[model samples]
Target: MSFKGEQHPGVQAPTPDSQGFRLNHTMLRIKDPEKALAFYTRVFGMQVMRRLDFDEMGFSLYFLAKLDENEQVPEEQGERTVWTFRQRGLLELTHNWGTETQADFAYHDGNAEPQGFGHICFSVPDLEAAEAWFDANEVEFVKRSDQGKMKDVVFVKDVDGYWIEVVQADRLSALGD
Candidate 1:
């Protein structure tokens, strides 16, 4: 539904046209799919659900869980694409046309002074275990739960320098601390 906090006076009671609206995916412009895909799938357990390439456009990739290799998937490409869009909690990473060749290409990770887009978050089943795993894997951290102003949250950075907030939804009480 709506984001946390009560809807403001002007935005209360969503309009009829927004009835079926859903956030299909939040996209990030990545410089290299190889590095980005490895981090997401290896670290977060996401799989490459679908790969869409526009003839005129550079990139359109959707990552999520797909049927196991032994399982049968839709034979038609169109059907596969539809399956990806219909699923919930999608994270799409797109690479520009020629960024692959540029060794120094990078995105303006939105955490800078003129911040607009903040970060995307993931909820783990166990907060303590997740933090340990991240530590073992050397995932860069913006702040750790123990040292931060907040008690039970972790902020990490992706290959593209985007901040990823990790949390345990069950421990809602620790957030305010």
Candidate 2:
């Protein structure tokens, strides 16, 4: 399928076994789960749907999502876990046992020398309101809506210094230009 104006010639329809495949989640290794979770939940209005602790592995996974209108998270652990796995656009934060106490611990945010993973984006209903919200919350701005050539899109950094792009998606058609 063609994406935006770029099409990979080698890309084609999924094979039978992959017919129903979907992007389930993207994982980001975090040094401190508490700060990361607070940033995502309080600033972006996301909620923790489920969490899995792998004590043997010395790491834990936290699944969070900004629910759609009228969407409800399952109250039971078994059902919540199943629902979480089935949903799309999940942000999974992986916390290793003791990274939080390490003074110099950091993760590659993928925007430096060997840029790989770029960023995650959030679509807001009102661009102006979102900007004000970010300002009120003292969120670090990588690029503010009015700062650059793009007029209505904004970018902010999380506690981990990961880029989170914010935009009024209704105006996204112009971005394709």
Candidate 3:
């Protein structure tokens, strides 16, 4: 069978390439991109790689990266972008001015316990130090236990009320062999 809007005569369909698939970045709609950017930069220490203004769309898009990989840093310079020393993952902040700019996604849902989408998680070195950093910044967290293999996890929220998990493990072996 032939696909729609195609002018090929007895040609085989092109197969999709799946050899090198990797996560590029994650995008999230934020009520306030400015506040979210600040929270991620100051608290999580993510670096803003590039922020482009879409005049047509009437919104601003911010691309942030974990500051550890110097090579992955965007070569673009100038703009209201901030970068920090966190090398875990990339966070994309989308700010929509005209429409409703908000989210109610939680990372986890356990048996009808006020569940939505849950949260994002990151591994840190010291739990005490990490908790202290958030505490100093007037951030609140809920320590999580009974996580099966992964215990001693702490739950925190960003400026936009997004859940974030902070996990600490002493040695590599502790994560399981």
* TM-score, one value per model: 0.85, 0.92, 0.65
Let me know the TM-score candidate 2 reaches against the reference structure. 0.92
Ranking according to TM-score, highest score first: 2, 1, 3
Provide the clash count, candidate 2.
Answer: 0
- What total of clashing residue pairs does each candidate reach? 0, 0, 10
lDDT of 3 at 45: 81
Q: What lDDT does model 1 reach?
A: 0.81
Worst 10 residues of 1 by lDDT: 60-69
State the C-alpha lDDT per candidate: 0.81, 0.91, 0.67
Better of 1 and 3 by TM-score: 1
Candidate 1 lDDT at 6 equals 65
What is the overall TM-score of model 1 with all chains considered together? Answer: 0.85
What lDDT would candidate 3 get against the real structure? 0.67
Predicted model with the maximum lDDT? 2
Clashes of 3: 10
Worst 10 residues of 2 by lDDT: 1-10
**Which portions of model 1 show Cα errors greater than 4 Å?**
1-5, 65-75, 174-177
